[model samples]
Target: MAGTEGIDITRRNKKPRLLTDAERDQLDEFVDSIHYSSRYNDDHYEYRHVQLPKAMLKKIPKEYFDGGRGTLKLLWEDEWRGLGITQSLGWEHYEVHEPEPHILLFK
Candidate 1:
């Protein structure tokens, strides 16, 4: 059999692992650290811009953490709701803002 060289398949098609106790705690703490704020938009409509810090990257899998807006949103939507973040049906929901690689701003 011939050997295949330079064909790395590590972490390919891998699923996110369950967070450990410490990781869970870290995530919780970070979530708690986030502030809930509602500001008026240019149209004078009240909108929220919640910012998620990159601290989560410490424990969360990079595959999911850096997975773009929708992925990031899906990962934290539940937690955000628990923090009193309303949905678009009732009020204006937040939008994912990626101002920098280390920060996630949902405004």
Candidate 2:
């Protein structure tokens, strides 16, 4: 059930249903394509050149889990510093600002 790709429908007097072999193969191809792209490589590849700490890796969100290679390059200036890290070992720092800032609280 875990790895099977199919819809199981149980009627009042019938057995469950399942996807055909063709359907399973199609799904597998789709998943393989996703991993072949750069995003998946970034997420799963060991950044042996950088050696990022475990704490920083844990901060990454689910959306970024598999498709965030290019997205990481666009992080805000403050965010980079807050994460206590830098992009690439020899890159220069650049200042950037959020397009709009709304104060949510006045405490």
Candidate 3:
């Protein structure tokens, strides 16, 4: 959340459908629990993500998932930057990975 000062990171979209207080709270909790790690794989660093709790899948709005299309954007310099929604290439750590209904992972 460091570079999100001017960005509305809580809401799922730029439309009028704002997040409910409870949803916002849940998102905040998820953000708080997020951890980022990098490991040297070959000559490059590979970022890794921790598997999130399954409960988060229910707490967040359905629109946030966007059928695997990212509802969230990357933040940089206090602004939402490019990196528009694209299909995952299977190696990206930030892709929302739900191997099962009970397993959720994101970066």
Candidate 4:
């Protein structure tokens, strides 16, 4: 018997993973609910997922420091936030200390 190849295999088998009707509807709703804001010329209502590295933690600027104690102090002084310290959304990996809002995304 000759082994299947190219389009023959695709025609014989269906995708292993498939989204249900409800799941597809929910995804459509999520995509339609996005809204844009004019405050900063950025769409504040978009959803994004990103992961940062430990070495890039030293790039946060010195303005969004909040001027408080604890981890904030370390970030303000050294411009680097210690790993496994606190849970901050705006500054997930590194403490953001700059006035202008900045976001970094990696593909």
Candidate 5:
């Protein structure tokens, strides 16, 4: 969401994928329902997973998951994970728009 590939954040294990509006909405709802743990979750190779929902995970492409690597595995699957990774890596947020002149609503 914040960084272009390799600009501020590392590229995910799988190729970069863009989410559609509907997908983004669904992801938001799913994230709201889950209590995922990223840094202290089950080990995947040398890294940890965000501990995603099995049902939702099934719908995403298989390549998104690291195929059960014990350590150093990449668990990124959706927009949430991407956002997390970007933020955790200290990716700077770009300016969306310059602030316009302020308007007084009431006195």
Candidate 6:
């Protein structure tokens, strides 16, 4: 299938599964309740990120990335909608939603 005889050219990279309706709602609720005050918050810096379940992405065991970490990972809390990020930093918020199926939001 390729320059090599045994290579499976048909094989494709893993892709991210989209967020379910329920998950999306839950994330939104949290963003509103935690990131923003009922009235308004001028200090908030909202950022959106999509961290798919590990199973949805490629498994590079013992590797942070095949290459070096990028800006996205630096922002990626890998937690629930960036709650972990807030613990350390302020005025920053994010949402890590699952991408559309086969979309592969991350490398």
TM of each candidate vs. truth: 0.42, 0.23, 0.39, 0.19, 0.37, 0.21
State which candidate, 1 or 2, has the greater TM-score: 1
Per-residue CA lDDT of model 5 for 1-107, tens digit only, reads 22243321332445456556665555554454443333322232212223344455544544443344312222233434542222244222211111211110000
Q: After superposing candidate 3, which stretches have Cα over 4 Å from the reference?
A: 1-21, 28-45, 68-93, 98-107
Put down candidate 1 lDDT per residue, 23-97, tens digits, no spaces. 566566667555555554544343455554556545454444434342343233344454333444334223345
Cα error of candidate 6 at position 31, Å: 1.8
Q: Model 4 segments beyond 4 Å from truth?
A: 1-46, 67-107
Global lDDT of each model? 0.42, 0.26, 0.37, 0.26, 0.34, 0.28
Q: Write the per-residue lDDT of candidate 4 for residues 47-87, one digit (tens) a residue.
A: 23222332322432233223342122212111212212222
How well is each residue in 7-103 modelled by candidate 3, as lDDT tens digits?
Answer: 3344334443456666666555555444434433423333344433455556655644555444332222111111111123333323333344322
Model 5 residue 87 CA deviation (Å) reads 5.6
Off by over 4 Å in 1: 1-23, 61-71, 74-76, 82-94, 101-107
Off by over 4 Å in 6: 1-13, 33-107
List ranges where model 2 is wrong by over 4 Å.
1-50, 62-71, 86-107
By lDDT, is 1 or 3 better?
1
What tens digits encode model 6's per-residue C-alpha lDDT throughout 15-86? 322345554544443333332222232343332323343332332212222232221221222332322113
TM-score of 3: 0.39
Sort every candidate by lDDT, greatest first. Answer: 1, 3, 5, 6, 4, 2
Sort by TM-score, top down from the best: 1, 3, 5, 2, 6, 4
RMSD of 6: 15.8
Worst 10 residues of 5 by lDDT: 98-107
lDDT of 2 at 77: 29
